[model samples]
Target: MAIDPKSFEAIADLAYRESGLQLVVEKASMIQSRLRHRLKAVGTDSFASYAELVCSDEGLDERRQMISALTTNVSHFFRESHHFELLGQKILPGLIDKLRAGRRFRVWSAGCSNGQEAYSIAMTMLETFPEMAKMDVKILATDIDPKVVSFGRSAVYPERLTTGIPKNLKDKYFSVQKGKEGDEYTASEALKSLVVFKELNLLSNWPMKQKMDVVFCRNVVIYFDADTQDRLWPRFHSLLNSDGHLFLGHSERISEPSNAGFINNGPTSYRPIVAKR
Candidate 1:
């Protein structure tokens, strides 16, 4: 059955409150289509019932499931190549020096979908600076959906999904196995070892105590409202170490960087504005 206007509004409100996803009336059909299976899974015959269950305090787990179903998880290895280039050329040199001085280099791949982004960072660092394998460095890859977090932790991808990975890197970093359908590639142990995948909601309290050197929250906040986006910029700023960089999706912008204690450093890149002592 189609989602009634009231139920759609209720679902939209819940999504906005829990995940900061803006579900507009225009995308009602898309939302309905995506949620059809959810109704069956929850044993609900109508959208109204599903909405009610998800909104109630007792429906916490169901709420998580609903958000997971509705979230868009499209990602590819090196989807935006320039960001990787910037990291290798501009960011890692300084971080390498710090690593040698007994500081841990940390990168957070927020909304890291299926682990491609975090793995890409690992592969790039391991390839460009081979000594990094022995260094104290880690990539924290997080997504709101537990399902995608599990997929990321697996560090396996099918042949089609491996295309975005460069030929040389693919050969160097992934082990290929022939599957019944085609081929599957698993990220090498070195790459997987540097990454930790966890389920996280951006709207919730972040648990990590260590500030990050680089945070890639690309393509995730485009779904949020202006107010939500504004609220997040400062939080990201607070989590970044001095001179640490934050990379957003190509289409997303902070509007005013200084307001968030950041200065525009590159295309879709911002660095925290450290105050002079």
Candidate 2:
């Protein structure tokens, strides 16, 4: 059954409040389609019933499931090549000295759906600085959805989902295995060792104690409203090292980067502004 206007609005508001996901009337059809499986999983064929369950205090877990169903998790290996190029060429070169001096180097793949982005970073790091295997280098890949986080931890991708990966990198970093879905490529242990996957809600308080050298939160904030986006900019600035980089989706931008204590360094890339002495 089509989601009635009332249930749709209720679910939309709930999604926004819980996860900062902006839901529009135009996307209601898409949302309804996505929620079909969710409704069935909850044993409800009616959108009204599903919404009622998900919106109640007694349905805390269902609320999470509803949000997960509503959110998009599209991802690809090195989805945007320029960001990786910048990392391999400019960013890593500067961090290499500090890393070799025993300082920890960390990267965050925020909203890292299914782990492709994190694995891409690992491949780039190892390919650029091979000795990082022995260094204190780690990539933290997180998503709000536990299902996607679990998929990331599995470190396996179907052959078709891996087209964005270059042939050389694929051969070097993934092992071929037979699967029900034809051939699957599992991340090599080296790549897996450098990445840690965790379930995280961007709207929730972050638990990371260390500042990151680079944070990749591409294609995520577009779902948030202006206020939500505004709040996130400063948080990202605070989480970054003085010389750290923040990469947003090509379609997303901070309204006034300097206001967020950031200065644009490259396409969709921002660096924390250092204070004048």
Candidate 3:
């Protein structure tokens, strides 16, 4: 059944309120298509009924399910090769020195989908600074969707999805698992041990206690409004340690990079500037 304009608007408003995602009119069809399965699962025949349920207090779990269904989770190992290169060559050297000097090293992969980005960070760090495996180094991977968080925690992917990964790294970091359906690659225990995956909503309060040395929030802010993006820039700056790096998607930019205390180092990369005492 086609969703009515009223139902679409209600869903759009709810999505924006909960996730800061702008669901314009053009997305109405996409929204309806995505929610159809939810309606079926909930035993509702109409969009209006599903929308009402989702908006009610009793629908909290259903709301989470809806958001998970609608979110985009397309990611692969080393999606942006340059960022990894920069990390390995320019950033890791300084961070490694700090690690050896008894400083904790932390990296955050916000909006990490299915663990690839976080694992890539771990792989790069391990490959560059092998001694890091013995140090206090951790990569935090978070997503709003619980399913993807669970998927990331599992660290399993189809063999075909491993194509872009460097062959040498693949040989060292992944174990091939033969499944009934197809060949699956699981991240080695060493690689998986370096990352922690959790579910986090970006607009909500962050639970992290330690400041991060690098934050990868790529391709996430584009779904939000300009105001929301503006609010996040300062928050990211505050969360970063001195001279910590922030990386965004190719198309995403810090609206006021300088005012936000970010120094543009390269395309989609910024380092937070420490204020003079």
Candidate 2, position 238, lDDT? 95
lDDT of 2 by residue, 196-256 (tens): 9999999999999999999999999999999999999999999999989999999999999
lDDT for each candidate structure:
0.92, 0.93, 0.91
- Residues 1-277, candidate 3, lDDT per residue (tens digit)? 9888888888888888899988888877887888899999999999999889999999999999999988988888998888999999999886677789888889999999888999999999999988888899999999999999999999888887776799899989998889866989999988988999999999999999989999999999999999999989999999999879999998899878988989998989999987789
Cα distance off (Å), candidate 3, residue 203? 0.5
Comparing candidate 2 with candidate 3, which one achieves the higher lDDT?
Answer: 2
Kindly report which residue stretches of model 3 are placed more than 4 angstroms away from their true locations once superposed: none
lDDT of 1 by residue, 1-277 (tens): 7889999999999999999999999998899999999899988899998999999998899999999999999999988989899889878875777788788889999999998999999988987789898899999999999999999999889998786998999999999999877999999999998999999999999999999999999999999999999999999999999879999999999998999899999899999999999
Clashes of 2: 0
Clashes of 1: 0
Ranking by lDDT: 2, 1, 3
Q: How far is candidate 3 from the true structure (C-alpha RMSD, Å)?
A: 1.0
In candidate 1, which residue pairs get closer than 3 Å at backbone N, Cα or C atoms, i.e. clash? none
Compute the lDDT for candidate 1: 0.92
What's the residue-level lDDT of 223 in candidate 1? 93
